[model samples]
Target chain A: MLRALRNHHGEPSVRRPLFSPVNLAKAIGALTVAILAGVLLSGGTFAYMNSTVALPSATIKAGSAALTTTGTPLVLTGLYPGQTQSAAFTINNTGIVPLVLNVSGVAAPAADANSLSAALTIRVDVTTAAAGCSILPGTAGWQGTFAATLPTANAPVSLNSTLAAGATATLCLSASLPPSAPSTVQGGTTKSFSVTIGGVQS
Target chain B: MTRSRILSSARSRIGVAVGLVAFLVLVGSGTAQATWTTLSSAQPATASATTASVLLSDISALNTTYNYTGTTSPLVIAPATLQNTGGAPLTYTLTETNTNATLAAKIAVWIWLQVSGSCGTTTVGTAGTLAAIPALPAGATSGTAGQSTVVCIATQLTGTILASSGSTLTANFTLTGKVGANWQGTDPSSITQSVFQAADVTNITCSTSGHGSNTTATVSWSLPAGATGASIYVGSTLVLPDTSTVSFTATKANVGSATSITIKANYASGVQSAGVVQALDSANGSGCG
Candidate 1:
């Protein structure tokens, strides 16, 4: 239907459609610009209000599995076949957590002549008594030749008991040469070995 | 949309996804980082071995000279001292060589260790021969270096031996040292004495009664006219050393089933009567024979 509208000249004129392509494009462009402007203003407001106050620094320190030993650097002299020599040492768990203990042997150098590491039998036990290692109190926790027990470095065998935090355990060690030990072990043969006591957090 | 724009949008989406995945991985790893650790300490040890050797002192005095014409039975020889002179410990054994088989069969010897007191409770071997002597430990842990053991020797005859007057009987004693392997040095000694006819003790008897796991043997004997002392043995252990007591009671513990008790009389002429043996049973707890 034709519609009439009044112009400035007071003449009757025809009205145009509201959704014409040109008018629609102009509207769309204006909306797009407004949306972009809103996004920028919102980002600027957030940046202005974002104040960081380092919430009183919290310190977190890791727990340690510290271990200490005594009666080391032991020297057993004048050993003979069919004879047993004993020694006692202590392992202390000087940390804040409980620990599981382990024992291992460190072999002597290959250059040692007639090394007794392979021929000597070693036994380790936990003891509460004051007696020598010859009559150790508890059952043996580990028993074998040094060479066989720790064929390589850091190889460990567990002890029979665990140590609580700040606890100390007495360990009795006995070294023996069997009566059947070969003649090579005689004639003042000497050998130097090592024992390693290790602990892991339980 | 333009092809370039479409490709750029796809690339942006991929970058966002990768960043999200990376953030999750970091959070996940943070949870597993709370693992326990191990710490260790070391101790050093050393050992040294040495050869074994022994030394015998008072060897010359170990020889015994007895005149049976005036001497009584169970001739006591001079004591010998054995010392461990090497770095290692040692054990000892004895061997004997007799000049006459007849006299050897009639003769009995007892060797024991006693540093300053009476003969040791344990003898080296059974009477009459030293061939069955076991390796005797000279000291606890065998004989350590510088350790000394005093040995006591005594000889007696088993039966009456008729020999011509002024005749001499001789026997050589050899003591050897041993460790895991036999040692090189040995100690030699000798016994020389006159032979004479010596009478044996008569009417020797043994009776037994059991109490719990122990059995007590009561022995009584009529000593010969010239008897000096007598010894009693419960199994291989000497319960009573030479004594003048005619009747004695010896007790043994843990006699599971049965055990033997032996008694011998000693005379003034280095002679001992034949040993009398009697078996004691654990079931005879309430009765005495």
Candidate 2:
């Protein structure tokens, strides 16, 4: 019996682990609480954004600008030396964008070879007046001769430098032959004298 | 177990719990750093204006003098030019109004416009002929700067332009139109061109021919259609009166053969012309045959 008892002590004995139902439940609960804390912290920002999030698309298109002009004929009959004639024209911007204007005039040489072209002078002015252009504004936006000295951007007679689209501007052309003209210029005729107004994108 | 050992075990468990909490805090910090972003892009808006413009250039001087006789024809009178300086093509209509009644009643004005790229000098309905004015494509100018078109006034006498030789004729030719291509907001305009003419006689010719084996000779004359108050004579006998053709019996000699015939023409304006005399045999008419 003593030998048997000694042998039993020598053999390994299987004891119940610390896995009781109460202990297991407690461990599972602790694990669940920790996992819940982590998930809740990560979800806080996501939930706030989900309530107020939005995604939208938009589009933009281009615009256009155009210009046109109209007016009655400018004619001077029996024009004698030292005489002046005045006429008017209308300028309209038929575009979508505003524009800057450049105005100029060109005159042909006298049809008579012996006549003097320099003795004849032409004046062009931009105004807000009505037909006949009898009364030009004192502070005319642009005033110049029919020579190469046209009005440029630097000294532009602003017929509306920022002329809005579909807007109108009126101008007057005044032509004259200086009284100092020589007698030899009699019976001289000039044809195809023209005035032009060009527009530039501002 | 001994109290000290139990105390050490308790300290290890508390440390484990603290470690778990610390790990959770670190994981939460990492998760908090994640984020979502919405990107946006945009373009600048812009627009450009349409271009419309027109221009006319000066005309050249007229010929100093014109002759209706030899070498010269009653076709072209004075010269001028037109051009398109705007951004759009233009149509031009050219019309004439005579300011002087004497000149207007004597002649009718016409327009002769040169074709683009080619200068036409002939009259209408002929090769190298100029296109009539007031034509659509005929008077259309390119929408280009410095583009030029040539024009001239031509004439037709109502009765006779030759009668007014050495006299001056005055008239006005006006060109009017606007941009033809996509025209908008632009007004048509008119430009006046003045013309003057001094006239002269050019050529005079006469031919004689027999009429159908008869003893008659016919004289056909080539003069300006407008010539008037002129007289023709055959051997001192009045015959043709400013007519294109006239016939007269040949004078017969004793031999039965016709004698030569002498023809002369005189204008009321003191101008005179002579034709060669013609003789004919018995079978044929005078020397004209």
Candidate 3:
């Protein structure tokens, strides 16, 4: 009797729902889709190689003594006024970018501060010369020299820089100082003003 | 009864198995293959005197070698690429100058950068000088980086520092060509020469009104730093750009003076008398000849 009672407790009587063909197919379809999902989720997650073409932005330095650089050199006294200096420098776009330059800076005399804005802006197409060399456009063969003039003397002197994307140039500046002054200070007081010298690839 | 029980148990197992499979399928279909499409052309792409043709856009699109960390995320934002449809390379060769100058002056070319849009009414945001860049100096070296960028800069621009920029003398410049859209609105804004280094002048305002009505139209030019000549133009109608603006007035004799009259005025790089013209009209829509 005890064994019978234990069996009765283990087994329960319940009616099953009718099996349908539609349900069977659906079950199979679901299982297949699940397998596909697992495979796809991992497959799509991938790392691809990328590329880029870089162009340099313009960058400038206020005070530089680079002699090989091509452009209007900074006038730090010891010369005549309105004089111009020119030489060449090397600008290679080692980077995947192009650099551009716009030259404009005034020669400020001791007595007067020249405005950079008033300075004539000329587009000097810079070319990357032989490795490690660059040439400023328009200055390639400028024979006529210019002199930097000082109205008073001993004025603060400086140079500005402007550059754009991978464009670069390297040349010397032909700068001039005030004419031999009359006031015994013919040597010039070293008057300086904020001036822009050249630009660089950033 | 035993057969029925067996059948029911089998069906239940199948149902559970199928349910799990369906879930898997749904998860399998994901976003990997659904790549985003690049636009045929990027709008709001600007061209300014400074950085006008910088390969910023082209470089940004290079996916072969470089990688991008675009300013905006792809999931939340879509970036429009600035394609140089002009077919020509980016040519930023425009010169800014103050042709006639009595004293020393500084000239700067300001450039604006944009993230993206349909080349619509975007503003010229930042500033940069189109200064001359020299080669690497002695003891100087260079590095090759910046090949990839994620930030989509749709436009570039040129600007001059004027009153708002706190320069004594200023010039007026319009964002022409691609910028005909309209500024103060989604239209692309102009990159102006906001500041000229000259210290003589202060307060230079455009008539605000772009042009005038028929007959004897007035194109006003004023300078606090004072000017000698300010050249004005109506198309190539005026051969040379106006002469001076501080003290002298640039007037056109034949006055169709129609508001539709397209006029453009400019002062070379270092001059303060910059944009001294009315707005652009269909008639004034002539490119620099």
Candidate 4:
């Protein structure tokens, strides 16, 4: 291995026309690359050549990207108490780091969002998660509905994957006046709730 | 012999040139290198009612009120500790509507009733400001719990609602946030005043003025079935209360329209008038004679 490296180290001791710029240049270039690679693999964050070779490592850990919305989670409103109404959901992250959220896991009705998800009983379906993670409020990605009653106890928070420090994520939520299904929903109604999003990364 | 040798030399030189050229480019690339990585997470709403965080509605800067509350329980419903929208003085208006518009006629309305807290010998309403809990740990007081929207609502004395007014009353809601204050948003209220129905009522009258000897007089009145009790007055002279219409009787010897009358309920003269007189007639018995 030592002898082989020597064979190609720096300029190869090739006897040829002394004026062959291409050949000489090639040899010099190869040597420079080999040496530079050795330096880079050692964790060179910058390419300052002779600068501080301080090999340092950094890690990004974001707090949970939490979300909050404007207005009551459950509203006792409609043409009547038992009247059908549409609603919207929003997501936000208040963290100092960026996070990726998988809306796939969020169950909701099909259509609108790139994926599908279903409604949860007595819940908005916005569950909590660790820092730097989140999911869009409803399925079909942006907006959807509970397709059921909205209770006051449950607190849904779709966390962003990585909450960039102090960054935020927002998703607008609107009431889903179901076009069809169930005896309670009345199929479809013009009644709707103004959906809003609020949140922060921890 | 010369051609062959020259070709061999040329091939070796080209090979070295190619390799060296590749190496040079690789080394130069290091001078300006950058990398980026993205991160993510997963979340979805299985249900609803995510956060109960108290959002301070009308934060009065000019009003500069130290505190505020929206219910009789005096539970601070806004700007909670470590939990606030962090805005300038805001406006919060509470509006009330008669949900039972059909039954709202003749109903009274009380405007501007708010939940207040105690600031040492102070009766809430306009004095004490409120927090979730004046105590530590930010505990919730009575007003914070319960779906009883009653305490949070205000009403006026029983007023005569006019059926001619369309049986419905709507309050336009608005909020003026105090300027130069810690808050700048308004918590506008879209309150609904649901109305409960009361049974229909009819006036009871004595058909006859006076009764002759052995004369049989018929007395009748109209009312919704739920008549718990009623009363009758015998001219300013006396009053009698009857629980059931079937057993009510007034068999006085002398009865006439000129006889004064007064009605009493639970001992006191209920809404009706006193000194009411009844007519005495021969065809029928006097009013309650």
Which candidate wins on DockQ?
1
Tell me the tens digit of each residue's lDDT in model 4 across A1-202: 3342225557545444543557556666766666667666766476566755666797877435443333344332221111122333334444434444323222333332211113211223333333111343344333334453321112334424443444444332223212222323211132222322323222
Among these predictions, the greatest lDDT belongs to: 1
Deviating ranges (above 4 Å) for candidate 3? A1-78, A81-96, A104-168, A177-185, A193-202, B1-289
Instruction: Please give the range of 10 consecutive residues that has the lowest summed lDDT in model 1 chain A.
Output: A146-155
Across the candidates, what are chain A's individual TM-scores?
0.60, 0.54, 0.26, 0.29
Report, for candidate 3, the interface RMSD: 20.9
lDDT of 3 by residue, A13-57 (tens): 454345555666766876686678567666746658777888898
Q: What TM-score fits each model?
A: 0.49, 0.27, 0.16, 0.26
Q: What tens digits encode model 4's per-residue C-alpha lDDT throughout B1-289?
A: 3546766776677677666656665766556743222222322222221111123233221111111111121222222111122221122323234344443333332222233431222222332111110111112221221111112222221332112212333433333222122212233433333222223234545543334544433344444344444455555444455533522234444434334343322212122212223333433443444
- Candidate 3 per-residue lDDT, tens place, B67-174, comes to 112221111111222222221112121222222121103332223222342323332334322232122122112111112122222221123333222322222221
Residue B75 Cα positional deviation in candidate 2, in Å, after optimal superposition: 60
Report the Cα lDDT for residue B211, model 4. 43
Better of 1 and 4 by TM-score: 1
Per-residue lDDT for A1-202 in model 2, tens only?
Answer: 3232223558655433444445555765687577767666656555344455566875677555555656345654333344555667767777666667555323343344424344456555666645447775565445444444655423434445456667886767665555455544444455445555655666
- Candidate 1 stretches with Cα past 4 Å from truth are A1-55, A78-83, A94-96, A109-115, A128-134, A137-139, A149-154, A183-189, B1-34, B50-53, B62-76, B82-92, B98-149, B155-172, B177-289
DockQ of 1: 0.23
By DockQ thresholds, what CAPRI class is model 3?
A: incorrect
DockQ of 3: 0.02
